[model samples]
Target: MKNDITTRRDIEQLVNTFYDKVQRDAIIGPIFIHVAKVNWDHHLPIMYSFWAGILLEERTYVGNPMMIHEALNKKSPLLQYHFDSWVRLFYETVDELFAGRNAEYAKEQGSQIAQLMHHKMRESEQ
Candidate 1:
């Protein structure tokens, strides 16, 4: 089915599937397992809101994502790798879950965000 602007459920399912893979992946899995302490049931909805805001411009998510990532950065040296993996998983998840422009839009935004974060992290390391 084609994903519309109001594809929060689709996004949530995609995120959950991505996280399931992330939790099992070799390079990036342990990082999330260690840092994200809460149950997926509790975390998924928050992430759903965050992605919903990003994709649909819904004002549902209020947390500062940069701050959260910054905190996580302090705990890991492979920030770029983690971000890359996240973006890759996100794109794959979207491709698997939905058809049409919404998936493309999600990947475009995700790529931009990942690039920006990678630049910032590299700058901070210098």
Candidate 2:
């Protein structure tokens, strides 16, 4: 079992694998490619920093995540679905790569973030 503080390398691998799947997923692939235009080559490191901050209590992320997601919501209009898929992929990635307390923490934090994002997206609609 590996530590699950979601290190830079861990985050990188997770995002890479998840996006690889996302690129092929029918429901979510087009949304990400068309709306976010996520250049995996460029975006992965930023995401790594963001996740590192979340799991490690570091300050690697300094930008406004909500604002970014809000923009994405406006484009996708399936924010909840995206959020759910994101969590699902994240859990699967962590489970595949690590275990023990770190993995548990990742699950807990990922679930909470997903729920929070779902709520925020719903709120934005109202």
Candidate 3:
């Protein structure tokens, strides 16, 4: 494990590693590949910016995640299991790559974001 994430490189590393796993995961991979059809070239940098904005206060990320995820849910309704699996991968990736406060914060933030996204998605369905 590396020291806690401290720079853009660290955030990029985390995002890349986590997404690599997501792109191949049995449960979640199809959601990304078939349903969402994510284009990593366009998506990865945005994620880097998103996490950087959260962890480093970079203020580089700009977009409404809830709206995006809500749209995705409309295509293939996200369930608790999906969110749980995502958070699990995220936490695992963080744990694998780094250690210390920022690492913990990354996991915590990922959890909070997943919960919020899941809640909003569910609420929108109702």
Please name the candidate that would achieve the greatest TM-score relative to the true structure: 3
Candidate 1 per-residue lDDT, tens place, 31-115, comes to 7787656477877888888888887788888787666666677777656677788888878787777777767888898889878
Ranking by TM-score: 3, 1, 2
TM-score of every candidate: 0.85, 0.84, 0.97
All candidates: CA RMSD (Å): 2.0, 2.0, 0.9
Q: Rank the candidates by lDDT, best first.
A: 3, 1, 2
After superposing candidate 1, which stretches have Cα over 4 Å from the reference? 1-5, 36-38
Q: Single out the weakest 10-residue window by summed lDDT for candidate 2.
A: 1-10
Clashing pairs in 2: none
Q: What's the number of clashes in each of the models? A: 0, 0, 0
For residue 64, model 3's alpha carbon misses the true position, in angstroms, by 0.6
Which scores greater on TM-score, model 2 or model 3?
3
Q: Is candidate 2 or 3 superior in lDDT?
A: 3
Q: Whole-model lDDT for model 2 versus the true structure? A: 0.75
Candidate 3: misplaced stretches above 4 Å? none
Q: Name the weakest run of 10 consecutive residues (lDDT summed) in model 3.
A: 117-126
TM-score, prediction 3: 0.97
Instruction: Please write out the lDDT profile of model 2 over residues 9-60, one tens digit for every residue.
Output: 7767766776787788777888878878888777777877777777667687
lDDT of each: 0.76, 0.75, 0.91
